[model samples]
Target: MPHTLAYIPTPAPATPFAVGETVEVLDREHVVLSVQTIKKVTRKKVKTDCGREWMLDGEWFDGESSYPFPSIRRKA
Candidate 1:
């Protein structure tokens, strides 16, 4: 009898929002200005009514009240 090798699959990374996309952040809506990827890290530059800000994917998982991830949506 021959034994078969088991193949393991890895999950794909999540995609970041694109520029000109509308995102709801901090109870307000904003537009994604840019998406930067450095060293496998993805950061989004967003423009809101208050001002422009940078957001990272890790912020959503972290338990930091001050830094929260915003709800991203596509512009219709």
Candidate 2:
């Protein structure tokens, strides 16, 4: 029996929503504006060149209030 290697995938930039990195969320591309950490919880503020914002958690979980959170594509 062959053992399969365990691979831990990581998002680009090693840090989510890194400043100046282009990312795609919900099929749209935007650049990271800034990242904020409050009480150890991280949040990323991303916006488009035109000032359009696609609000999302740092983890890319866009679930509704108290709803099930699912992982989405971290980058383009």
Candidate 3:
């Protein structure tokens, strides 16, 4: 038997962010945390102007593929 890593995509939808792009951070209740531009972006990290970061390739998930802290969204 072979081992296969399962990654069932989270039901929550989050917008992937890029460097120099503005985004809004929201709490579990969808309350805004902060609105700022991305300082740095990578598969392991996404740093914001406010010094907040989330590590994930697709939106807001950590190395463990779990969503930690605030979620993100495009600036309106």
| Candidate whose TM-score is highest | 3
lDDT of 3 at 24: 73
In each prediction, how many residue pairs overlap at the backbone (N, C-alpha, C within less than 3 A)? 0, 0, 0
lDDT by residue (1-76, candidate 2, tens digit) is 9966442222334454544554433312233333322222225434443344433442333333311111123444
- After superposition, the stretches of candidate 3 with alpha carbons farther than 4 Å from their true spots are 1-15, 57-68
Q: List the residue pairs that clash in candidate 1.
A: none
lDDT of 1 by residue, 4-68 (tens): 54322212226565444454332222334333322222344433333434344322222324233
lDDT, candidate 2, at 72: 23
* Candidate 2 residue pairs that clash: none
lDDT of each: 0.35, 0.35, 0.63
In candidate 2, residue 5 scores what lDDT? 47
**TM-scores, in order shown?**
0.30, 0.28, 0.58
Against the hidden true structure, what lDDT does model 3 obtain?
Answer: 0.63
Model number with the top lDDT:
3
